[model samples]
Target: MSGVTAGVLDEAIKKAAIAWVSVEDGPAYALWCMPAENSIVVVSGPGEQYAPGLAEATRATVRLRGDHGGLILVVDAVVDRLEPGGDEWNELAPQLATKRLNASGTADDLAARWAGSGCAVVRLTPAADSVVGAPDLPADSAAQPPRETPARVETRRPFRLHRVRKR
Candidate 1:
């Protein structure tokens, strides 16, 4: 990476509270993440956001948004799964939990439940030469249809202030 590109990537990764990660060239999913040890840490599973194919992917694309929520930088990243209870997990998990906002419990408590809850902690190490910023970003909006979900607004008759009809 050039000095400029490296600086931009580092700043973006550090300031971004959420990143759009596309696993195995699939659709990008917005996930909460933290910058740690020059890499990005993201957790996904039950009780957390879902990042399809992230748990098994060897590589992925990470897109960081600017202050205005527009795409600022795109980079290819090496995906590594942190084994629960291992050295890496022990080191990073608490940090991630601390970064998590509106969490129900203390950092230690949250990190403790992660393994049992089947959460996958993934580290995305940005590739040195894959940084693509402003001028090089694609012209396309990169929009996609929303994924299927069970929740929906229920259809019902509108309620009237009075039951009787006016003559």
Candidate 2:
């Protein structure tokens, strides 16, 4: 089955975080990460909806997910519960700061940051040119080939035995 795209998964994760923060009344935002690729995408609404809360939550989630492995987060709504400099907001600022500063780095550097946060990173994109053409296989090989027969089978019936003595 086709798996969800990294971008799609990132959007979903952000929406979930927004919902978690009860920012349904505000605008929606999304955050996603390609852990293997050590990449993150942040999308905010046209308005200033869940941008703040979504941003904060996204960072925390990224850090947490990074601990186990890389993750994607999406925030669906905006919440105005806290100011950017407030204690709670400041506490979460580091993550956002990291996101901003590391925004343009190599995947390896991104992976390092994720690892520093005690998480793993990955990239989920299928390698380009992987499906450019049909793969060649040996002519002798068959797809869904027939199964081989067993060498021997046991029977329930018993056979009479004759013994011969050797001098």
**Candidate whose TM-score is highest:** 1
**Against the true structure, what is each candidate's TM-score?**
0.88, 0.21
lDDT of each: 0.88, 0.32
What is the per-residue lDDT of model 2 for residues 83-126, given as tens digits with 9 covering 90 to 100? 43356334433443354342566544443454344332211222
How far residue 122's Cα lies from its native spot in candidate 1, in Å, is 1.0
The sequence of per-residue lDDT tens digits that candidate 1 reaches over residues 28-137 is 99898998867799999988888989999999999999888899888899999999899999999999999888899999899989988888999999997888888888
Q: Which residue window of length 10 is worst by lDDT in model 2?
A: 128-137
CA deviation > 4 Å runs, candidate 1: 1-4, 154-157, 162-167
User: Candidate 2: where is the Cα deviation over 4 Å?
Assistant: 1-29, 33-81, 101-167
How large an RMSD does model 2 have?
21.2
CA RMSD of all predictions: 2.7, 21.2
